[model samples]
Target: MLVNQIDTRQGTNSTPEFSHGNTLPYTGIPFGMNYFIPQTTFDNTSWSFSPMSHQFAGIKITHQPSPWIGDFSDFIVSAITGDIDLKADVTNQMGSYRPDAATFNPHYLSIYDQRYETKTQVAPTTYGALLKYTFDEINPKIIIHIPKNGSFILNENKNEIKLLIKNYDSHFNDDFKSYASLKFSNKFISTLITHQDNPKYDSMILSFNNIDELLIRLATSFISYDQAHFALKRLTNLNFESAKKTAQETWQYYLDLISVSDYNTIKMSTFYHCLYRTFLFPQRCFELDSNNNPIHYDLYNDKVKKGYLYMNNGFWDTSKTVYPLFAILIPKEYHQMLLGFYNSYLESGYLPKWLAPDERGMMPGTLIDAVIADAAIKGILTKSEIRNFLKAMLKSANQESHDTRLGRMGMKDFNNYGYLPSDKYSESVNQTLDYAYSDFCISQVAKLLYEDKIAQKYSHSALNYQNLFDPKTGLMRPKDSSGNFKSDFNAIRWGTDYTEGSSWQNSFSVYHDINGLKKLYQNPNFIQTLLKLSNQKPAFKVGGYGFQIHEMTEMVAIDFGQIAISNQPSFHLPYLFEYTDHPEYTELLIKQLVNQFDDTMNGFPGDEDNGSMSAWFIFSCLGFYPVCPGSDEYVFGIPIFNKATIHLPNGKQFNIKTNRNCPQNQFVQKRMLNDQPLKSRSLKYVQIINGGNLDTELCLLPYSKENIELPFSLSN
Candidate 1:
């Protein structure tokens, strides 16, 4: 939502400001900024803030405190006592591997403390992680003089080392900028490394206020263990100068991978976070130690027998949205990401789940199938090696495609039966829908390379879900093995037939291709039958698409209480209306959903899968969404942010001019290609790919236009 028609950021020429995510801060967003941390949540792990001088501004993550290593000591002890090999059991130890019930009580927390005081319960974000956990800038160096000269042993984790400094005499008066300089009676590193580490899932930019804050953070985070500075012992054999050079080079190299031309803040933060999230997985294994070569994996990995590179907590779920969006926004890296998946498959015999350094043990489903196949077709992964993996993808899809325990038990005999077999883990209408969608993706990859027979085979498998769509109720629902509608379940219940929380959700789950789905209803009688579902009420014991469910949105259940739209499984549900006569209704629905679920503060409806969940918001606000990953297209939806400039990776900038209207004027009126009249609810893939800008004219029209063909993006 824009206020007074002002952009949240007015390009890069303005002063850099930041917002405390946990509290209301007048400061704008910080970019290329380094935030100082006075505390961290990785429990009991010792750390301190000491940033290099030239790293500019930064901030810290301050909101809810998180469960730290200190919080997990008992768990660690158990893992170790149980002889849990650090490498092999790293995922479990990381707290990411647990029964769904186990994770309900814990949270992922990263934040600085007591920096900015505010009225909100969320935080007083004063500083960042003390050790200045970054070194990506040129001449990135920090001089830490132990107050009273303390003896400290620095501990290195998956990426960087940390420590605390205090009680130094040569101090600056309360002059703000002077606080950034270090006063040392004892020699620290003599030289320091210039980069820091962040998980692959966040933005590398730290948000901060001033040099003094960064220094004050270094000055007060922790007490000295013994006075004698650990630096006197460690720099005995370090090539700090070359390391600094390498760090600068790494920054430039990463920058080279994508373009940043939009509202610099949005593009940089968004792009950096996308890149940062990658760090969360395929763990960073090799670092330049004076001479560059792979060191044994980091302490966390070494302890867990995991490698240096970790892909982190998110996987195929985001690959559907984030990874595929990157295919167009940042194609080269996405290509590399595909290869990384391929290689992980080769080393591990299956596509790594979250890839927490390529661990295929977490999460359900072989989701990589959709991403890989999509990437191969879009030319993002044009290598023959990828072609080989496509074959592996097929095998993986066939062997591990879990079609809800019930869908496979002779349930395909629809019309004759009204319900699924009354077994514990089946109905599987939802699972079957996704499986069919995945099959469609597989078929697309086969088709792109002219593998006609392979494509034909998958095409049939992909359509298998059509058998589940019930004509009487128009719901993608369950049927008995004899094809009769299930008597025990209501069409509005979300849990009985699909993933997460319903048919309202599953009915719209077909993301691979939309036209095929529309064809399913082309027979007028079939379309009318499905209309009854729109008015169905929630049949669940209790639930609403709210922040509690996470993917904040308006969730309506069909089949009693089986589908909840506020969860990831149902995140893409609302747009299903775009495939009907009520396209504008779908457009209005998205705006209402955004208002209900997101704001500038907590921008998502639920636990954002890495950035997969947030990616939906980002792109939708830009007037579209990447519903089907790897398709090189975005389905038309609604734009929340009044105007957004998408900096293309191709060094061009495109702006989503949201001129149509607000929640009231939610329909697309007349679209234009530059100045010429256009007739689609969506734009062209070639236009976005080749750096074309989109400008839309909107009106609060009661009816949607039928003249233009909606690109495949908004199909289903």
Candidate 2:
């Protein structure tokens, strides 16, 4: 079974200073409202859990997408046996557990506490989870670790506890709270609520006298206590085994969407592991009422709103791969997500950039425009929806918001000067480049709705990237408001004008018009420049950040030259080679890049960023990538698998077959779609979803001649 093959710990071996994937071993349904992970530490920080740690703190229900973002509405559930101080710190109560012996599955989690002499397991549902505890001795007790500003009521008569937690990192209302209900199968002999001076370690303990085993059903809601109880009531009829089966079935349904036939067990495992990460983000933020209507807590207005809402994703990362993959495999969910994002626009004045629970707005540009435009071009959204989203896009592009998190930064300067002035804002070069690509996305949406004037206007704005092109350095440099490039420009310096990258990495971010980017260079020609970027020494200066960031460390660790696959800004760099005469370089680079990933705790090269890097691997393994999300084409690479099949949402199958498909055969000699010669080295969105066969012949040697039928470019 695919679910069995997945180790939830794949990418959990990480710390705040260095990351392997910077991911947690999340055990829950795909895109579940809450995920339950085995917490190994009691640190009041984002690095709360690590697979390498032997300490068994508890099972924590977390809404933490990235460690940098922190967690919201989170709490821990643990089982204990011997005498332990209730008011003591969480680390004091933690027991030793063998990390190697623990089960870390998507649908379930299991760990044996050696000190407590108890075994704990959890099976998660959409809104709730079923927990089982088996004790080796009497006096089995359960501990609930509540965060600060949390209160709970124990109803001994009903064998249940009601909890209210008020916690968030940022971008939440004062009234933002999570209500949860915990229903126990066994009656507790005694219950005690302990308060600590340090609010982070507050606890409640429930002791069962004679019972050797117990079952706990827990449910939570952001709406109200009634809704939380309702969610718990839905789980009342199911046992641990039944709930586990349901969770497994739910995950299997999504995991089975793409089937790969490869004899290499390790490679196949890595593919599935990466695939598992792809569906874990943009989690459901809305819940169904008694009438089965979707409703959500609106952080913008602090009111209960009616609609399907999703959260915990940053469009800056996901716009590159996740949504585009959804366009091909899960259009229904993608369409619903579009409505949800549109509803966010209706609630908040602008569209979301990064939504942990609400818009934390952590990245550059309102890149959701790319996601919406990709869906619009693929016919995944209605005309009315497209028009509504286009208005929101234009609002963000043209207007500045009072809250910098809501819309594009330096919007007034960007609109007036054609680029974000370096003097006005930090990371101005990235802001300018991202805004230009977003402008192109807006143009695509406008063209879909047949608004030619709007399309043309945004298309013109899209070329604003060219404003920062410094011909002497052959890189995109920052420009000041005085219409001059910034002096003392250094291409190898990190994060003064760029976003998490140096000019060497962020320069070629012209996703909508790579050929146009190539036109800016003369002596080096874009091809030679790309060669230098790939072969240059992997050295960097901590320019703006002053200290070395993890991204810089990760890039040097992999030694992939300026192409920092460790971060999203460099995701499309390798694929850019496809537009030049040397397409074989792209195939070779993709093959080498994918080797950095595996099916272990340290599975990824760096922070996966809510499945952006995972989707990158998924696409690269399939021999293609959505380099430009707003564009409807996927640039080709060499397939890693011998055979693979995509079960399209429209009840069709898209098959991919690679001949001489091995690690050694990394270059494509010939390509065919449905048995016809495919010379363009690209595939259209329609062609993929409509279902056909893509056959490629790969070899060790490069193709002698250039295949010039390149992908979509504004200049073309």
Candidate 3:
């Protein structure tokens, strides 16, 4: 359960509104599933940390502690019994859970949470009839009085308790369905049974689709059957008034960020999706508990653990897309996240590549420089806190011992030099290039924060990536000391010098400078460059479609899998349209990418490094991307939705909308703001700050017109 306020009301117009991103907040309130999988139960699942709503804690879950509850088991069986001296023939259709049926026995059910125990389970004396105690107090003494025909019933002017049964079916592992029924007091049903098991698979499948309907049916059943009586309002928010009020308010907050005027559906979707994407990464580590002590884990291992241990990270790649998205749309959370990262630096020497506090270590390139630098610029973390950490990392970058066993350069010195000097198993060229890029990110932050000297030093360091650029070859070739290409420089095959990708993916890796790279070639060209790269075809296939390989494996060419999308620095590639005047091509790539991949269970189409992979989908869907973070502007592109609402960093909303259908509307047919023609191609910082409506109409045909945004200028 990740979200609510989605108008779950069983009304004539209740088509159930939902956030359409890969990840959305899990309203703690149960929706599709029978039980609420808790935040502590969070994992790196799907798109976000928990794949749940941040307000999940606010949603009340009926805590029923009984032997019938089952998890990671064979099946669920109601342990109810009737002392009516009745004769009955009960089929075993309600399959077995455990061989001994004691796995979920009351006493053994490890108190997943103590709050549930205090709320639901009580002494048999506290409820009604009494029976036998368990082997110790593990078993309950409450007796379910049944009719002569072997049916269960219960109710009184007493313990206002409702009853519900979740028949965990065989499809539990696959399609995520549960066969559940409810009742109030069991007094009205002639069967005298609380809930009967069903072997019918069709009914169970039907029950899963109308999730909201099922919830109402179950709730209504409680009162209708009188087998168990309870009100949905008896719990969360007390009533719909309170819930809807909160939901609308939350919607308003996100809408204000990407303030689109004449709201079309596509613009609305983008804005909201971007807002949703920002929260997907470092999830709700802070959840209120029974005592309300904020019982969530930390993201960066912060002091109070205020932000839970949010451990998904792809340092270099994320710094480019994910972190910048946070910096613009949600700086406060971004601040907290950076603080947590610094904490991780203190705890774990040399920050981390892809890190978890418990060390789920992913890949290499200690690119915390980007985060630290940006944090300093954005005032997210103090310079004093990060300075020492960055300095301390130089040793690992330049002189640290390398271990080929670890899948990185064979020697430590290789990381800092931008090239390994005389190491047999060093990815020297790639290391140097990556190190320089990270320095560029760090420099931007220092430059912004009046640390001119520090920024310049790092900026110069960034230029080191150019050293690998071979003039004759016009590629980022591997070089030896006196400037000679590595002997086994097989541009055709990958070797110890390069990472998983070949020169095609790595050549233009120096993104900070297309011009400098242009100088490296005899003829400067973007289209030719892209066309050539596209034609090269992966020697073994790097990322997405056709031939998939074991992700993160050290294969020569097989790239596209789950982790590649999650990892690589391929995000800003599409926006090259702005620089190259190939906006059409950009639209082509984006449309193909979006239509191809979705929130599937087979991981992401590739490695979704933290939320970087998710961020790409988010920004593209929203019709623009943060081509240059801290620039107060996002490079515009064809949006995939009719509407999108962006939740900006300053707690305001911005909207983007187009003609009804989004992905289908690929061209910018007409555009307006509060019904005015958009004279400027770009949507500026001031416009978003004003918080108004932005309306756009998209077309299926290309306009073949040049409507470039305020030509991208270098901050320098």
Candidate 4:
């Protein structure tokens, strides 16, 4: 029921091309390897499914993580009637469709082509898809088009087609082969295949005299065509409707895990939509063999291996909120994912920072350290597994990777100089802050494993952020190798010593040691500091980046001074108010943010990169947030819903009830945890999993006079 309410297109519509929510209306299972979308353009661009586009190119099988990262092993499937456009480009061959009359959901997508009077629907399995079509006229046809550098063959049997695609978009290798097996329902009168002069764009069109309906079952694999067929054998017997129902049921299971009761329909829809986005990443990259043994293609080794693996995620964004959500809602799957990540480490010799098919050392810091530490703290991995995890983590922190493309960059410099210098890496400020948090994560895991010597070493290393902080300016400016802070610093500048952000956004990212970070501020007036960030004019000086990046534009659009909630670094900015004298200021800011998002196409403040932004909204709407991953704590915020129930993994229910809850009633007057008076503005991980009722009374005025405990801090 909840799946039916989700549009699946909430964040696909962007203000610029890829500024806010560079997301597609993806249709697949929770962790499906392949996501299905109606490709509206034939340009083969990363953004193929714009919500406003009326053209129907085909149903694309994509493994695109983000537009900035590009796509791999992608191809298109389309249904047409009466005509063959062998030479037509995407626009010339495209059929107009009404966006309003289309069906878009997590499990299914349907579009009616106004030009041909054809309705196309598609449903997905973990590694395959079932596409059905209905035509209003006679002489129907099906087209399977592969993008640049592709070739395919139509088996003379007329029912089965074997396809192969060569894509070189990955960073791990110059090129890789992807295979697919497609089975059609009707006997084709004739099959005509075409190859453009450039040899990049190739297609096969199957013609039928007349068919009211048709079904196309497709299975894809990066390994071989036989494996692709092996993946689809189990689903070949299921009808179109049955496949649709099965996919819908699979999605409903996850969507029903958390239930919300509110009179406001838009807010409820927004909550469920955000919740839906959180489970769509880290897709399953491994498939089971004949004996149900897991096997995957090892890009690092350039061979197939027997092991479960996962890909298509960046830890920089996900470490903040995604993994913490999984620890609470789906710990079993989380455990499996950890094992998968461990496999990546075993193959590549280091944990991945960003993976799409393979390691793409993007973003700052090897943030998987936070993921591993959080899983260990939650007891998700076994004793032996944790030990292995610790070994891989230690190696990453200490050793220099064989390839500069893997592991933490400038590791030797950081170890020797105590901080990565601006001359060494472009994002030195972000590197210092990110690695500091990662050091704290390593310390947490070491402490859990009784490795006190290692724990103390990394714990001390976590304070490296202090070396970059300038108390006078209250910013973490980049430093040179000689231990001197770099001059000519502008706080509003974007991407000089920071990653897609300025010093202000990356300054307070010592989530593991907030108190240590706060002490670096001379004024210690965090409330005013946050206010300064929120009230400043939306001005920026493109520092290292000569022109304005999309992040700068998004931050200016949000107009929250310099606080760029448009990106991940500023996610915890609003909650920082709790550290100051006035905790209620956070409540107002949280309310403003939650109200900004809705259940429409252009719903997010910025790119919901791999569900980080969505997870932020989900946690805030539930009245808590995992501000720091390995800390095992969630900072309290204002709840948007009146009542909500969480189906905890331990079979107990965690309920949150708010009295007189509304947009106006943003402040909490009093709170009770399990009928006991609560004074803290935070909740522990144990309290949430143990499952109990948390009730709060709301008021129009701030509860400023009350003495409330601050969120979990290292000093406290």
- By lDDT, the best candidate is 2
TM-score of model 1 (CA atoms):
0.60
* Candidate 1 structure quality by residue, lDDT tens digits, 426-467: 536754665666666777777777889987877777676677
Runs in model 2 deviating more than 4 A are 156-158
Sorted by lDDT (best first), the order is 2, 4, 3, 1
Q: Give the lDDT of residue 483 in candidate 3.
A: 58
C-alpha lDDT of all candidate models, in order: 0.41, 0.89, 0.41, 0.85
lDDT of 3 by residue, 1-716 (tens): 11221211111110012112222222222111121211221111122112222211111122111111212111121222222222233222111122121111111121111211111111111001111111111211122211111222233532222333232222212212111222222122223233222321111100011111101212221112221132222332223334334434454454355443333443333334334333434432233333444332322232234232334455655766677566656667666666555545444444556542223334445665656655554555566655654554443344443332112343344434545553443556667676766666666665655668867876777677677776555567777655567675555344356565555556666645554555555643555665555445345433222233333232222332211232354566655555555566666666665543343222234444345665777677766776554344566666766566766665566777767554555667666877788745446655764556677677777666465444333322
- The residue pairs that clash in candidate 4, if any, are 21-607
For residue 182, model 2's alpha carbon misses the true position, in angstroms, by 0.7
Model 3 clashes, total count: 94
Q: Per-prediction count of colliding residue pairs?
A: 128, 0, 94, 1
* lDDT (Cα, tens digit) per residue for candidate 2, span 1-716: 37977898888888877889999889998889999998887777898887778998888999999999999899999899977777676678888899889889999899999999999999999998999999997678898887776888878485899998887645547678889999999888888887655436568889888688899999999999999999999998999999999999989999999999887888889888888899999899999999999999888888898999998999999999999999998899999888888878888888999988888989898899999999999999888988888899988777778889898878778889999899989999999999999999999999988999999999999999999997777899998889999999788999979999899989999999998888899877788889999999889999999998989899999999999999999999999889988888999999999889999988989999999999999999999999899888999988999999999988999999999987888889898899998878789999999999999998888876464598989999
Superposition-based RMSD of candidate 2 using all C-alpha atoms, in angstroms: 1.1
Report the backbone clash tally of model 1: 128
